[model samples]
Target: MADATHSTGMIRVWDPLVRIGHWVLVVAFATAYLTEGEPEWLHVWAGYAIAATVALRLLWGVIGPQRARFSDFVTGPGRAVAYLRDLIAGRAERHVGHSPAGGAMTVALLVTLGVTAFAGMGTLAAEEGEGPLAGIVAQIPETDGPRAYTGDHDEDEHGEHGEESAWKEVHEVAANLTLILILLHLGGVALASARHGENLARSMVTGDKRA
Candidate 1:
């Protein structure tokens, strides 16, 4: 659909789905990260929300509105690097939609968040015999030993503990990476807004930019 433009020169860039999903993801990630897995139910549900939102966003990027489509802004790394160079020089071209660097950051955040969420599920499954992967991950055979029968050292009875630890490490690393990417994303947004004389964050909320 064509974006609606008004006399005030503002135009709809992000669709309602895009805008809502963006905020939902922001809240969900913050909830999951800050809780640090305490109040287990909340943390798990928040991670699930992040996963679902990212999945929907990926689909939307394929078939959404003009500005939301990946084809509109997902230029390659070379273009992103070139845009960054131009941006640093204060000579970057203005884009009503996402710039190359912005597009790259979007993709990176999506992938990193997805990894974090799924790795958390894997950790949950392997560690607690819970979550979606529980059936698969919890099926590891217990060792035929006195410790296994006595439950004296259940964690060391099989490879499950090691598997759980590995998944936990992956989840933690991915979550940390997501945090770093988020900081970089915010910095880029602030810099781009200042350089272009526009509020990029407000544009995401109002779904408008100079047109």
Candidate 2:
């Protein structure tokens, strides 16, 4: 018996940078969460790692392999909507790379994670922390503008504005939300893989697949 989709020539799938960036982002995010606002040095390192991962992904998105570019998968919102409609009809198309919804999810995750990271870093550096960026933005009057975040003022030399409630609250909320996103991402990947006959986790790890 011959398989319907069998093909001897499996093509190269993932680029080196894409694979590295994906895993690096995962590890960096985990490290950041584990060390959030506690051990100053570890937390700062985690932030740096995540920032690096984001920067690397941005660069790779510009010059990476064929299937790794933003243009390759980040289709229009209308297309994404259409794809969702297909999913509802149980007729969603499976892509060798990221499907429409998955691609959009990737972009959303990157953006929201970036925002959460930026807010987290901003809050940490502004208040009672000694991050590398702490001294640079030491002059922004956070109270001058309406922000969801609030800073601390402990009169402590750790960058605390003076031990009031401010950025700390913001950081906590954002971190928790980021964790939720990560969980959702995992579940989505699992569901997609199970339904579509793909091993996405292995694809990211080995940079290849049974294509």
TM-score of each: 0.88, 0.77
Tens-place lDDT per residue, model 2, 131-180, is: 55566546566543323323232355875555443555666676777788
Q: What is the lDDT of residue 33 in candidate 1?
A: 95
Model 1 global lDDT (CA atoms, 0 to 1): 0.86
Please name the candidate that would achieve the greatest TM-score relative to the true structure: 1
Model 1, span 1-211: residue lDDT tens: 7778979988889999999999999999999999987788999999999999999999999988898899998998999999889998999998889999999999999999999999988777766667787776666565111111122334546645323256778999999999999999999999999999999999899888888
* Global lDDT of each candidate: 0.86, 0.69
What are the clash counts of all predictions, listed in order? 0, 12
Worst 10 residues of 2 by lDDT: 144-153
TM-score of 1: 0.88
Give the CA lDDT, 0 to 100, for residue 157 in model 1. Answer: 60
